[model samples]
Target chain A: MTGKAHCYKRDHINTDEIIPARYLNMDREADLAQHAMEDIDPEFVKKINQGDFIIAGEDFGCGSSREHAVWALRGAGVRAVIADTFARIFYRNCVNNGFLAIECPGISQQVDSGDELEIDIEKGIIKNRTKGDQYTFQPITGFAREVIGAGGLLNYIAGKVV
Target chain B: MGATITEKILAAHCGRTQVNPGELINAEIDVIMCHDVTTTPAIDMLTDRGLSRVAHPERVVVIPDHFVPNKDIKSAEMVAKIRRWAKEQGIDKFYELGRHGVCHALLPEQGYVRPGITIVCGDSHTCTHGALGAFSTGIGSTDLAATLATGKLWFKVPETILFRLNGKLGKGVYAKDVILEIIRQIGVDGALYKAMEFTGELIDELSVEARMTICNMAIEAGGKSGIINPDQKTINYVEAHTAEPFKIFKSDSDAEYCRIVEINVTDLEPLVAFPHLPSNGKPVWQVGEIPVDQAYIGSCTNGRIEDLRVAAEILKNRQVAKNTRMIVVPATTNIWKQANQEGLLDIFMAAGAAVSTPTCGACLGGHMGILAAGERCISSTNRNFIGRMGSPQSEVYLASPATVAASAVAGKIADPRNYM
Candidate 1:
């Protein structure tokens, strides 16, 4: 997947900032998309096109176990999130939701906003097209690879049960 | 390679002789906790997939917190859907309005949580159950739905980080202060993807309720769970609640630990975490006079009866400041009843504090006591993240319930020691 980067160089971009608690009451795709990242960046949704990626520092998606944050990002045309690290639950949420969360340590320092990123899922390599840089993330292996491969836990479980 | 308490519990659940950190295993769940916000989504996902069967109705407990009492039309519908699903599944442990409370508190109060069990919930604070020596952690909706259908979930055996806390706690220092100080010492994410095993003289001396407070915020330090080996206090507490059978798992003295931290608690003052992060904790004396508009006490973190008693001790004769409003929410209906019988409610209301039925609202900025822009609240609940309590411009300072009461009386952040 290829997308432009929305680089946020600070750490701890919590789920609350991604989607505030007030919007938690409404889970519709449109409603969540309408207010995604309103707490941190008011123009986040308007500024990104479909298939764009978010670049963040450490502890990205910290605080709150709300999966609505994932829905809000997906709804707002976020294709994936590349962070130095992620809060544990948020990382699993991405895997279970079939959303991409690439952990590229120090990736925040290497890229600027609006830079182009192309990810090769098979090789676990992220190429910075604009800067001609390459960073490697932990290749998804074992059961996790299969879960995402099967398009999330629900479908994976359905297949296993059947 | 001896196993820690967490490993012992997970190994038992997965039918293995032993398991190591970083290994993945599919473990059978002994308890599944469901609440309104996330359970509604899990239910919808299940129904959408034609997989609406509960693997074990008897093992699930449904509690509608977060937006309990229906904060709005949307929340009311979510609760209704959960009610319909619970009824259809024949899950008798569903605690409807008036009977419901925070899942972490209500589950233990009713004796669903016990030592040496694997527990899963859709809320982040499910780690709160680890206080009783259970291997509990939070999951997102997809995992919740899968667990609900199969009574099993996947887990990566987390490395254990041993925290040895020793020394006597001075007057006015509570478990909440201890956890806050620890979080400050270890920046957030210090223990990422690890099980925090707390032991030593201080943990042995603490009451079960106090221990719960200490274990509740393990996530703030990026721990998958926080646990203490079951002791006499744990056994007595469980025996008082129910006769259900439970196992006791203890870590071997030679267990492998990824890291170890030692904390000395002597003369430690009460603490308050400043805005933006739980790791931004400061000793109450070090914090300047920051005025607060709201003082809230409740959540899975510190909403137990003992927490209410601590706040009541400071608010017995004092009044909430003119500009500051106080809200006290007992974590469970049983706790609410116990507080009322003990006259804690009367003391709170007479002191101009509003008493609420159990709800996680306001703590997560859901409802009941949300703050306005430019407002600050001194809360006993965990996490002071940005926009956690209301408007993004609002600030939440996290402190002990006693400290919250004292601050409410002073109309700014104040030490609880002075009031005592």
Candidate 2:
């Protein structure tokens, strides 16, 4: 995955902020995408284009089990989210949806907003193209890889259940 | 080494004799809960994938609590889809508007949960069932879809943390305060991907309602689940609700735990979590007169009958201050009726507070009590994330129902002990 990095040097970007619960009335991924990050950053929807990356600090997506956070980010054309750490449910949601959420320690310091990033998900390597810095992340492995290969849990379930 | 209760339960559900943390396993889902906000999305995904039928409809419980009574056009449409699907699927456990309540509280109250089993829900507080010694946890929309289609889902067995809570709580302190203190010690992600097993003296003395409140916020600490061993109290509660047969499991004396924490709640005061994080808790005395705009007591956490009793005890004969308003929401239909029977509703109304039927409204900012920019509320709900209760500038302070009642009477952050 390669994209322009939109780094937010803060931690605990909860699901409530990623996609506020008020907009949860509309579960259509497309509708939720319009309000993504509306609570934390009003300019988030306006600033980023397709194939952009969200670079964040520790404990990103900390509260709530709403998968709308992943849906909204993916729908907004975000390629991936690189955080220092992740709340477990959010990480699971991303893997289940086949959306990339990379956990790379010190990622927030290495990549600045507008920097370019090229991620080798298979190898768990992140190349900061703008800064010429490189970092490693916990690689997706085993069953999680298989689920992602099948394009999310639903497809995986469909293929298996049938 | 012996396995913890969480491990033993997961191992049993997956048909394994032993399993360790981080090992992946596919477990049979014993019970699943569906609510309005999350269920509709699951239905959409399943229908799109052409797997539109429930594999085990009998095991599924449908309750539309989040936007029930239809908050708006979109919410109404969302719930309409859930209602239609539940009928078409023939889910016998469906609870509609008049009978509906918060998902977490309703599950246990209806006897769908028991010891030594697994419970799944799309709502995070599904962990609330863990108070009954069930290995309950929350899943996302796609996960809900997959579980519905297959009756099974994969899990990465979680490490278990033993929290030995000792000492009797001080005046005005509650299970909510104990949990807040735990979260304060271990930040938001302290138990990431782990199971929190709360045990020892305090849990033994605590009522199931308070235990549910503690387990409900397990998600706030990033836990996979929060659990306790089923004792006589659990069996009694379960029997009172249903005649269903249930197996029981306990952690072996030599059970393995990844970590152990010793908490002494002897003189702990009423606690409150400030804006933006549940882990940002401090003693209410230190909060010093932060004016409250709204004091809310509801949600799966503290909307139980016991919680209502506590709030009513404090709010009795006390009028809500002119500067703030209080909203009391009993968690389930039964809880509401019980509170009404006990005259708690009358006290709230006579005390100049608003009482409503059970809904997760205002807690998630869906509707009913949204705050304007810069407004603040003291809530008995679990979270305090930014804009969690309303506008981005509106802050939410999380406290026990007792503290919320006291703060509502005082119109600011005040010590509940004074009322006690």
- lDDT per residue for candidate 1 within B123-214, as digits (tens), equals 88888888899999988888999999999999999999999999999988999999999889988888888999899999999999888888
Residue-by-residue lDDT tens digits, candidate 2, A1-162: 788999887988899999999888888889999999988889999888899999999999888889999999988889899999998888989999999888888989878999988999888998989889889877988999989889999888888866
Per residue, candidate 2 scores C-alpha lDDT tens digits across B256-355 of: 8889999999988889999889999999999876999999999999999999999999999999999898899999999999999999999999999999
Task: Tell me what TM-score chain A of model 1 achieves.
Answer: 0.97
Error of 2 at B113 (Å): 1.0
Superposed model 1: Cα runs more than 4 Å off: none
Cα miss at A162, model 1 (Å)?
A: 3.5
lDDT of each: 0.92, 0.91
Tens-place lDDT per residue, model 1, A85-143, is 99999999999988888898999999999999999988989999999999998887778
